[model samples]
Target: MKLSQLLEYDPIIVQCHDNPDADAIASGYAIYEYFKEHSKNVRFVYSGRNAIQKSNLLLLINYLKIGDVLEHIEEWKDDEFEGLVVTVDCQYGAGNVTRIPAKYVAIIDHHQKEIENVELSEIVSGLGSCSTLVWRMLREEGFDLDDIKINTALYFGLYTDTNSLSEINNPFDKDMRDMIAYEKSVIIILRNSNFSLDELEIAGNAMKNYLYYPKNRFAVIKAKQCDPNILGLISDFLLQVAEVDEAIVYNEWPGGFKYSVRTCVKEVHADELASFIAEGIGSGGGHIEKAGGFIRRDLYEAKFKDLDTEEFFRTRIDEYFDTFEVIYASEYEADISKMELYAKKKIHQGFVIAKDILPIGTPVIVRTLEGDIETEVSDDLVFMIGIKGEVYTNHREKFERSYQMTDIEYLSDDELLKPEYLPTVHSRNDGSVIDLSKHAHVCISSGATQICACQIDKRVKIFTKWYTETYMAGKPGDYLAVRTDDPHDVYIVERDIFFRTYEKME
Candidate 1:
């Protein structure tokens, strides 16, 4: 429904999502500005005060004089207030907000669908930020923009929600362009806001506490009493760490635990991971690259209390990494000799032979549809095999066996193997099939492939015919270059080499 239609009633209650983020706060303020301009009485209400990372958000609140609403609310006699209630940046009765009475008039948000009993609801995931939607509404209603406070709040909302415009895509192009054009000053304000040394210290400490599982290509970090906004900051930091495909941070709060998961690999979505982890436990949801969820503190502590603090967090973090395994569309065992011949001929011609052919200690490059990634050779990578002609490193044993390459499809520039599509490979030695798909692609450093082979799961056997004969001076566990499918690149082997190397050469 149109804002005009919804605002036909006077004295409205404007509420944002609980723990109001920048987008929610900005959207709330923008709506308040729109209504106040039309000479309507609106009071903004929220549950759970904002935290430290969102302190800059308060600047907008003060600048826009949203403090006036709080003042009016103080004067309001509970019985004296009678008006339609409208919620922005949140669904009616969502976990993010307190339960509103049946009097909810309208809802505006950028989240997925939720059970909201409001009379009017507009939830669009297409919008990059909820504030963008609010901005559009104000413009549509011809609200004045001369109010610096309103503009500042909206700008901060847009900046924080979109990660400084990093999350926006073509779908939000127009909205982003307009926001950028109109709110240039607001952007400057956000940049100048004091993020505070304490916040940075907390984030750094969280990183230091991260536990990495080489076999899974994932990491996890846990802490007590951290700002929710720091979750986003942590995710961004972990993505840049070498060899980390995905990372998660679980923060303990007074009443519950919140989890934030981030991925540089395209195959997995953060929201899906959050949902998977939250299943049969608490609540969680988010987008593909970034997602979050919450678990009641009592339940979380009860289930994980016996586990070592580091171990518990790491185990939970590794659970979802198994889903990223690389699986072939079909299974087959091609002759190793034929594959070797192809690689040898290609290598002789100065074409980087894209094959599973690095020795335990040979350094190699790993290239995927998204981009090139690198890691050092470790003990658990022996069972991973690249496609006959394809090269990449991973920890799982499922991708080792020969597989038939049928249809070839291209993924987006940033797309990687999704966890669901990974195929499991059975080991020929013990009649046991290991799922190697979990470690679909990897890079390894030079001179560490041999030591890496010893770390493979006991059930899988490693074949080494495809390894290069050259040996450089380095320890067995030293990093090595592993070949990948891309003809122009090589990757550092991060785990076991036996699985990644196919024997047919020596």
Candidate 2:
């Protein structure tokens, strides 16, 4: 139906966008008054609720007796608005109005065109404010605006929609002039619209975790579940941060995430970007410069489970720095090979050898630069060996109390020759003696010698002068033989465990 046909209907319902903002409310009221002058059955409706921060507008609305035209669907009479439904400031099925029936006759808005099938649609994308469009319509119809309440409503509609005239460029000066001529007190509106502490806290938390991606020319923030009004607050705050071209806020909601994307980049479309991110995951659509979307929690977790947030940002930053690579070539290419080599060597030599063997028991000895330190055999230290080594001794009782082959590894001769050994050596059970050739650094244990007695008892005397002569010949990674009186118990000690002399000979 045309505007003339829509005007012919009885009990017309004038609806605005869901959760009507100042522009939506003002434009809705302006149309409400226009229709009320010609008809008595007109009613106004909004899709969702408003916040307490909009108290000033609410007061103005109540004072102007606009509440008389307002009627929530739940409060509507069964025979209400059967003639026509005229939607202003929003289109039907645009996610802005809830439960709009198939009878919508006209839509007047300043947003991008939606609801292609409307009988009459007036979407002025060039207009800075939806209220301005309503003002134009009222003027074109020669409606006299003698009431201060109507002027005040139109003024707020223009001012708030333009973000107090901060959003429009200088080219829109005539529009600004027309808005200023209405003479709305901005200070009064702002002062009366102060947000509560809870609202302020919600905005503060959103800004704290803000992350910027210069390559994408966007900033992303995570906001707590909050009033939808806070989306505007976050966008405003992000615009003030230096160098940010676009701001996107993801707010956590029940089982899903809601996103509000805004940008000053005229060439970069926010709605396109929002749609791209929401594709195949959720739904989103809005004006070219500003858009919002929602993603379910399951979808987000599944897609980003492997993402490391810190590394993700670091990689983006690194990509940004890639653009200026030639400017810092020398600093970026400095060698780190020395540090890597040192780390590799340290890991190779730091090995542990268990003192007593048990399927899984305590009392393990870990050999490090400090010395052989005793510790318990636990799952924590099980990964310290290359392969398991076996130990054998004729004095089974002595071996049980004194030695465990739970772990072992090679060390440099200098590391193994330290006289400052641990004071907790176990007593040897066999009384034996060994002759050490100082020149050759050789130690040969025999059943008749004191080494045999030392094996039986824990206390043992080492002839260091002769032992070093025979054992201190080898380099860092060789093996040596440690013979026992029991031929079945003989095993070879790693050459790296011997002194430099023996290691070098091998």
Candidate 3:
């Protein structure tokens, strides 16, 4: 829901999850500011067993001067008041948030859905932080982020929640990190004040006690109840050990488990392994080398029942390694005996000429849902947008030979390719972001290119000749494919997409 919708009620009150963190405080403060701008009687307050005590949080509150409205209310006054009470960074009546009585209640959160009875609520889970969600909502209402305090609060909220932005996975989080302007001095102060002596002891103790699986050279350490960011620090330090190739650090929270994964090996991407470990139980993602995840206690108990948490992690890691076969296309040959020959079907896709939008030699970072890729704008470089809205680099010669230009114009969100976020290129020269769709045109597959493809029953990781550092993961039912003309050129096709875009030849 839009922030303006809550303006209808007077004397509106903003609430955050109990024991408010940086994200919670920032989110509520933003709402309070939005209402204050509208001249609405708004009060931002939080209630819990204790008031804010964290050093960095106190610094954030003092620096932003939010102490005036953002307060700790032992008991909410204005009994039987007819106004709206909005919860930010948390859902109303959830395990983390304290429920306050009001005539109308609304929730703005970026956590798993829990309170469904609230009609006026906005909850988009899987975001890096609630601050990004609030920032996006404020932007929708045309709220200016020029206020350095607001910018810093939002940035710090993201920074703290996502472990200094090393655990950020969503595009919205990255966009906020790049586009938003904040006071560096204030951020530095808050960041340095993050760890207390007790937390330092917790980190040190966690390191001394760890479960090591010698086979995979991975270490799992459980820190005593501490800040989630502490888990990241522990994992980062754990990965520096010469024998440890990957590290998993965790700390228990009231609601669930907070875990961080760090990996120095290319065989297992930290983000991918984190996601695999939390697959059906919770949400997890980040960068290749560093990532984090949250496992809901309810979901964990429901699935594993009485299983030890350590064993669960160990088994998951083992499954992650055992189920997948890593294939380097450059050194591998395909056997067609068990594979079937398939021809490409005529399908309209999006394409962007590399030189059309940027200078021929401009260095750029292409950002997509898949990941960010570094390349330079060149005459021979072409970007091919697949049916799933994924963008990939293609050679101009191959693009001409394998596809035909189409008259159909490309739109960011088409019925065929309903992409979550359209691809964009950020120039390293001047730090400008260019939407690839602006210079995009449609193309039709030639239907002459053929591949020997076979559905895979096991997990596969294919490092094609192009991307040596990153491998595309293929799960069961996905196709392992090789170009008919070049048996060594291997790749994977997702189950649904493979069937939709290819047909077996007679």
Candidate 4:
């Protein structure tokens, strides 16, 4: 939708996320300016259990002159004032943001993951910062930027959200940075803003008591209680260690523990690690390089009862490595042609093939990402097969060089059956037939009534109806009788029948 279309709703309200940060405030303020310029009634609002508490965030709000413009959500009386609500920076109804009720709601955010119920949203992930998105929107609408305060706010929002432009990976973030002009001294001051006294003490103690895993270059620390931001700070500080490639810091709260993770290693994704730690315990996810999550205390206690928290975290890290191996090992690109063949019929493909059956003269297709080869089975082959049934003496060496047997999988007979294609029961009344041609031998239970066979003698048949008479193996009802021949060959094989036939011929 166009920018001007936002004014179609009366008394429009632009709302930022809970515990509003510089980015949220800046983005909401930008939207507020656009709607206000068009003479539409708009109010910038935020709602949370606590107001803006961080010193740097408070400073940014004052510096940007957003204190009067932004109001607490509780201050607005729904009965007195009602309009279309617009969520900025953070998505509406997300875990981080408090939900607000409105007749019609629109969302403008930069978070990658989104929830439903958003009818109008301009969400763009990987933009580094939501301020960049808002800045782009303001520019696209030809909004005047005579107010330097707005520019400074947007710049600060972009700077802090992307960690002083160090985390900016997209063109839009850089474009917004270059477009906005700001004083270098202000940026230096903002960057140098020190952590609180409590935060400093927490980080210091965490680093001093951290556990170092040299094999994976992972560092872990647990604290009794600390500010959530301190975990992130300590996690970053842990990466400064020469031997550390990844850092994890967690702190206990009422009924759960919040964790912050950071990784400089390209192969280790902090987001994935956070989720791994919280799997079956709690919720966790964030950026690739920096991520944080929470785990319920009950889950932690169940594993760490009568043990130290440090040892518990160490075990968790080991579990993470084990899970990582299993999850990441099979994440490589698959052969599209082999995948198509596997989908069409549950037979040999990329990693799966018939375990023991190598039908002579039948075409066998082996495929890998590099390419695929078609070969026909030959009778004389031993641990090697012909490309097209031709005798190749060096087949083993050639095949080994072309294919890695370790990567290919040989499947068993039980693995090839498609559940949907299998008959529920073998019966003529239901028009259902059981398939048995794939098996060399068949076993029938005494309780089984409806009988069907796919192979009769040396001929292959589709599900043909058959019958059998019950016979004891040893004693009465000792075991079910096994049939060797159904075409009366047993009588010919008897000694009496053979002797009588010979006598008649004589």
For all candidates in order, the CA lDDT equals 0.54, 0.50, 0.84, 0.57
Q: lDDT per residue, candidate 2, 236-269, as tens digits? A: 6796677787777766656556677676753445
Q: Model 1: which ten-residue window has the lowest total lDDT?
A: 342-351
* TM per prediction: 0.59, 0.53, 0.78, 0.59
Task: Kindly report which residue pairs in candidate 3 clash with one another.
Answer: none
**Candidate 2 segments whose C-alpha is farther than 4 A from its true place:** 1-5, 49-53, 67-69, 72-81, 169-173, 179-183, 190-194, 255-257, 280-288, 293-506
Error of 1 at 10 (Å): 4.2
Q: If the candidates were sorted by their TM-score against the true structure, best first, what order would they fall in?
A: 3, 1, 4, 2
TM-score of 3: 0.78
Query: Which predicted model would earn the best lDDT?
Result: 3
RMSD of model 1, in Å?
Answer: 15.8
Off by over 4 Å in 1: 49-53, 68-82, 116-119, 146-148, 179-186, 301-312, 321-506
Ranked by TM-score, the better of candidates 3 and 4 is: 3
Stronger candidate by lDDT (2 vs 4): 4
Clashes of each: 64, 52, 0, 0
lDDT of candidate 3 over 1-506, digit per residue (tens): 88888878988989987667898998889888889899998888887655776779888999888777687876656576588889998887764565677899999987656577898988776578899999999999998878989989999999987868987756678889999999999999999997789988888888889999999999999888766657777898899998899899987766678799999887899878988888888867655787778788899999999788889888989998898899999999788899999999998788988988888999887877666677888989998888988888888987888899875668833645746567888887777888887678889899988999999999999888877877888989999999887788799999999988899999
Model 4 lDDT, full chain set: 0.57
lDDT of 4 by residue, 77-135 (tens): 44533678888987766645656677778888876555656767777655677889888
